[model samples]
Target: MLDLFTIFSKGGIVLWYFQSTSQIFTPSVNALIRSVILQERTGNHSYEHDSLRLQYKLDNEFELIFVVAYQKILQLSYVDKFLNDIHLEFRDRFKNELQSSQWFSDYTFKKSYDNILVAAENWGKAQAKLPKQMRTFDESFKSKKTVASMIERKDDKDNKKQEGKCLFTLVGKKKKGTNGTDDDLISSQEVLQVEAPKPVQNVNGDVFEDPLMMNRIKLAQKFSGQKKKADKQKSPKPEKAGKKPRVWELGGTNKDLATLERTKDKPEDEGDYIGADTTLIGKMKGGIQDLEVESDSVEESDEVEEIVEVNKSPVQKKSGGMLSMFKSLVGNKSLKHEDMLPVLDKLKDHLIAKNVASDIATKLCDSVATKLEGKILGTFESVANTVKATLTEALVQILSPKRRVDILRDAFEAKKHGRPYVMAFCGVNGVGKSTNLAKICFWLIENNFRVLIAACDTFRAGAVEQLRTHMRHLNALHPAEKHDNQTMVQLYEKGYGKDAAGIAMEAIRFAKESRFDIVLVDTAGRMQDNEPLMRALTKLIRVNEPDLVLFVGEALVGNEAVDQLVKFNQALADYSSSNDPHIIDGIVLTKFDTIDDKVGAAISMTYITGQPIVFVGTGQTYTDLKSLNAKAVVHALMK
Candidate 1:
């Protein structure tokens, strides 16, 4: 029996639903919508959340979703057939209402759903009862056998005819020999022994062997001797050097260590991020600055429109174009998979060229093909134009964030409750996790928010000192006298070789006690494949429970971007040992300025984790951080 069946609009309005049990399945269904549907992973056949496996089909023409959920342990073969039957039935019955946008109206689909489900179950049973087909001659391996192999050879036939025959008869049935005893007869065989012939010698007393063969033997001996000599003359391997611990440029001595040490009870002085006379002071009004990813001119959209119109014009022709496959497709005819294969292949290649992961590109193209497979084209619309437009829309929709990640507003809300907001930055090694953390810290302090930098990256040798250096630089920029002798930024570090999770917990406590507005925990940069380090990261996030968990990744990556994000998320979910795990909440894409037009990493990252890119690091300075613009990224990708 099905646990639940539902039909909903793409906009998330439930049109009709039936439940066989009283158990609430809202969370499971919503997870499917968010992780699979919204993430453009509909190419997958089923989505498993908790113990319920949800299978769904999309109604592209009507913008509807039909879903059926059941226990994962059950092998319900009829679910797919039932979903299809009910989808067609419901769509046919409500065609008029759906065409008129009456999706919100109450739908009485229980009777039709039951009839379809029963028929599907019966069909499945009938299929199970039928005998499995036997393999035909062509399907069997015998069909591959050659006639020559099946026939017996003449030599084999002679060997078989000679079987059970002896070279000598039993010698007249054992003739008697000496002493009147039965004796064996002499064998009918002859034996002859000969000595080896002596080598022939010439007058010079040289053997008559081939002169060239003798010469070759002598040369081989000479070469082998030379090789042995060369082996003995080889030099000895060098000894390895001892490893030296890294020394930071700003390394502190014993005397300076006292000043660097921080205590939780120490009171902080109040100050803003910038000084009154500072040049950047005027630009600090906004809580967080937005990224200027898109062009300032509005004419770019007009140019895009013109290009699209040109593509749609019949006068323009492409050799072996996408429309060639659809030339036989007449007006008001439904599109088929074969009709869209050529265009999908081209689009897939286009996406891959833009640095999108090959798997993601293929899936995206498959999803687009699925969407357009049954839709009809207009009278003047070419298949190429339709596909291009649909692909553009899909790209835009994918890049757009489903939910806003406003750190400044959340910080103010945490301040109102007199608690510090915590944000943890995590990612693979060398992806600039700490650098971007400092950038975010700068932004937070610029908005007059008291910020505490937590150095939880105890694994990296110079991580704490790096944060310390950034803290010093930011403090110099915003001195205590800038706002009534208050210090705008401070660092809380317990040195290296400490438990990062413990340090984060202590830092959050210290921030709260010290009345800081936010605590930015800079975690160690570790590769996602490092199990021990990944487990440590999971423990840190699980223990600290930061207000937001940001995965810092480099935009310069191509296929590796998918592996990093996927393994990171998988580690969090698998190692947390909780029903509700603390996975990555958002992404911080660094090195955005480096990748000029290959912005597919943004799409790949978002698609894999279903998280928005909250911060983009465009340069080395703290002010280089900016928010991600979906449209701008989509434009760059399409170009």
Candidate 2:
């Protein structure tokens, strides 16, 4: 066989020559190395004759520049161009690596060959700045006859030759086995290729020089002169030529984060996905096999040379052993700065119970991780404190604790004991009093309550309109409309009543006369301080006092107003005689539609008077109103 250098080098005398020179333009980094840089070092020597010798040294920056120039100069190539060239040049090296590694697990010869071709393409891209002569030599074989032959094939003639200028030019006739060619020379299998690139022009007339892209690759190279950089700074590789395979290098936190909890902008519910590409997994597994093979070879041969070179490759840095990575997390407070899965699990239900969001629950879990080591618990007090602080802040931004509690408590109580047979709703104007009343009517119906609604609110046209809309919701839930009649109400001192006392007398007289099993009185939320109104209400109590009085108040009014209601009604709890009247028996926290808030929710906490919050208004929709449960409120605030 001819020396590899003789085949590669552009210096050879094909005695009795029938020379044929083929020029191929390829985008490959390997093809980039085959570029003929004919510099005019001599000024007009015998009509400007400059010998085309080779420059041996190049930096990564130069390689990147060459890569850019190659793309611009080379025509689009596939098939027997870049891939075939790499295969012809490298030959059995990559082929052997393919069979040894079993790169394509399906393990067909065609697939393995393609995979090896792809890996070379990727390697070509990585070493894009390598000097042309040094690429093949430094690439795999060092100081071999291939390198020598690559440097000296056939010396170029003077300017008269102008070889490879137009098409596949015939440099000369072939030699016979590194000797003089006989007369009848047949086709030769191996031919030297030096790509004579045409100057390609873009539409803008300016070359697309990717300087940042070039610099990025330069910085990524393993040189002592360079400072270390974050993985995010690495440059993106250029696209491979057609039919050329390229390696997939997953870098950067967003792509190759080791932890399961990745904030990759995918949906929060997508679950843990850590380096889950089958092709990538196979590549990783191949590396492991390589390590195992090396380990076995070392044990058998007692080879110290192989062991010394282990740390030379970037693989040593990247191939973090799974066991070692786990060990690192053991004594650390966090793994990938993430809380344990168990902590998140416990916090999740706790937050849900407290009325917190999934995202906040997750944050709470992270905060807990700050106070712990692997498999160990954070302080019970710290955990509680953190959860409470986070949840309190969250709830204050959303809804009040006391109001939410009362709303939940009452609804739960009602649900537990039995949906209310006789329940009343009370609240101020625009406090969603009537709307909440409609909600209760709907909830009772949804829960299969024999609900009976009385539209005794004979004032506020919007209130009546709002309630009518809510009645539709109630009707849908119950499959039967609540019986409502306005004539049964004795509101506004209208028609025929003697005075306030007489009007109150007839209001109660008429409500019972209706003989309803469930009676929900929609009284006016005019004033808690009004004496005449209170007197009239007292008259109703004397006549046919209702079973429950759910005094409604605006929850967004915050703790101060809630305190007023609780204080006022709770004070009335002591009243027994006709002179001293019971003002408010229980509370229905209202106006939940305008606020899903924190300061607003905390403000309602001032009304923490042990009064069971029977109902809550959540949204403008009657369906939005949810009954507050105390336990649920406590969990929401803490978790």
Candidate 3:
């Protein structure tokens, strides 16, 4: 018996297929076979593996007819005749539909073609039962009537009815019992159903009879009884008398001030140091509100001294006391490398947890440690505060770029020169290259520059259509104020299966001729590992060098973004002959809001690549692009 049959067009696209009930070829296997045949360009061949055989015939038009069957049952002549008939019928029937590329999902066409395969299977079966002398192809299936016969029509109908019965049974409908009569199968009248049993009631009127529910009720009651008994066993203790609140002595009283004045006039001694509690160091730790020191009495001095209001709550007081104690212990000692080791370790762990590359985290920690060694500690300084200050300064220094491109200014300058400021966006697949390109277009339009989006992403299936959708949305949201179609925000697509580089070159020419200020070229998404695709991207850049090449990537990719940028830059350098070698001038991080806690991507990417992030995609809108803020990113990481 013929087990599997498939047909393919000249370009290796599947046109139609059929499978027998015994064994079927997987879609992937079918695609593999098609790719092999298309690549090898075999005319007619038979391949055997184990007990199965795969035979295919290529027609004059390069259309493939493939059949998979068991080796023992194979009759080459009969199979060849069947294939010829199928090809003739398919070409004659689907002639008009095959001329277009959009006829893959025609349901009526599929149904009519499927019936022909049924008739062929039926004819094969009938020929198998005949004597050897009478088994000629012409004798068995010469007439049109014979070719139109179907043996599985009744079986197909019965299968559909059984499917309906299974669906009804699944959805709580009553099924026909084994002893059901013919009337039972045909009747549509409603049958009276039995009512469910009433649940048993307990003494407390709880009506649940399910065993699991009964067990839960018993367990809850047991826990509640134990909780009540435990609560009764505890007794209240007598409250202790509260201590008097400590008063903070800012300056002395009037009498003490006068005595201090009298003593100041009397003599000078070497042993006149104040105690730790009354010194300036103690006041700093308690959070200084005010401080005053005078040798004259309050009446004599015209300046009225403001007193510091200390916290009265015991917890606050206790915390203040602990701070004072710590300050006194470490006030005079210089910070050693040993003192900061624990803090640096913790900082390294924090950076790694936030998705910073492991090596980058180590470098950051080492940098901070180098700056902190042999540093003097003030009375109120703590290790955590020092580490934060050092880390912030280091990150800010790393994130600050040496050269920055003001896109708006560049566009205005290009317009003054009567040329368009072109920027090409590239990235790995599904990283939102096209959407972010549209975002940049919207940004340019808002900045008073006439913009055009070039939909040069022709490799992917629906790349052109996706760009068109974006253009329509952007036009609807922010329509051009004063311009014709040439100058307004328009999409230029050469459609799919065309050379992307050629499309981009033409787009730039179009922009120059149309006098647009900026042209944003969107390229197809490809993986960094795909050398052929990456080389094509490099060619696109080399042929028509854009003013800026920005790498668009996902923030959630973390350290992997670093690898992508590096490899892309290397590819551009290796392929392009330009003196400046097409490197990523900037990065646009997409889905920035999705990576809630892992925010080290921005820091790691900037630090590793030395490329500043230009804008971040925060939401799905034209106006959702936000300029990168270094302080905000640092704060988020530290938080």
| Model 1 bad stretches (over 4 Å) | 6-18, 25-35, 90-115, 126-284, 287-289, 292-330
For candidate 3, give the lDDT of residue 4: 69
Residue pairs clashing in model 1 are 269-486, 269-487, 270-486, 271-486
What clash count does candidate 2 reach? 52
lDDT value, residue 111 of candidate 2: 55
User: Lowest summed lDDT over 10 consecutive residues: which window, candidate 1?
Assistant: 299-308
Q: Which regions of candidate 2 deviate over 4 angstroms?
A: 1-421, 447-515, 534-543, 570-585, 597-607, 629-632, 635-639
TM-score of each: 0.71, 0.31, 0.48
Per-residue lDDT tens digits of candidate 2, residues 567-588?
4454444333555554555566
Each model's lDDT: 0.78, 0.39, 0.66
Q: Please, what are the lDDT tens digits per residue for candidate 1 over residues 397-508?
A: 7878889888888989999999999999999889999898888877777788888999989888888878877887677667778767777788999998999999999999
Backbone clash tally (model 1)? 4
Question: Model 2: how large is the Cα RMSD against the reference?
Answer: 38.9
